[model samples]
Target: MIKKPPFVVLSKISDQIARLETEVAVASPTLANVYNDLQCQIDVVVANLEPLQTISGHIEIVERSMETILDFLSSSGDKSISAANVYSLLEPLHAKIHQQGEQLRKIV
Candidate 1:
């Protein structure tokens, strides 16, 4: 199966984040060399964000896979494992995504 390109979209996001960071710094602070600092921080943040987005995508795939497995388990004549375990694994992932989303919202 053909899968979507993950990093390509992320690269665009990184560029946007970098541009915003630079713009924010240049527009604010009103200090000498503030642009340099803004660029640095933007680079740091974009670097951080790219990986987080990748992780988020992976988590989504995992959740879907888990759901599929649960479906298969239910369909067959077997009930060895409970779906709760899959949900339990997803709890932390869900929380992390929510937290990151909040952080991103604050940026926008």
Candidate 2:
């Protein structure tokens, strides 16, 4: 068995390193473009989510207002309560409004 000198082994290793470097360098631009595309997609996703978040917040505010109104009406005793029930009249409306608002929010 023959052992190679240290300098010869080092030279071979350097050649292999150079070849690898060249391969990576050649592919670098394509890799960079792919990275940029992924970044753009992420940006688009984040940008799209903003409007939905805003709409959800707005819907929450409206729901809270409706709840407050319902509470206020319940607290205030009505003289003509026998004719029409407040909960029956308003509960459906609040549910409908909340449902529609939620749908709209999702569309955003």
Q: TM-score of each candidate?
A: 0.44, 0.50
Give the per-residue lDDT digits (tens) of candidate 1, residues 2-61.
655554554565566566656676667454255456556656666666655666676677
Task: Say which candidate scores most in TM-score.
Answer: 2
Candidate 2 lDDT by residue in tens digits, 1-108: 789744455445555545555565577967655555554555555556555556666667767877876687777776456435667656666786677577676765
Error of 2 at 32 (Å): 0.9
lDDT of 2 at 81: 63
- The CA lDDT of each predicted structure is 0.63, 0.62
Candidate 2: residue pairs that collide: none
Q: Which residue runs of candidate 2 sit more than 4 Å off their true CA positions? A: 1-27, 81-108
Off by over 4 Å in 1: 1-32, 77-108
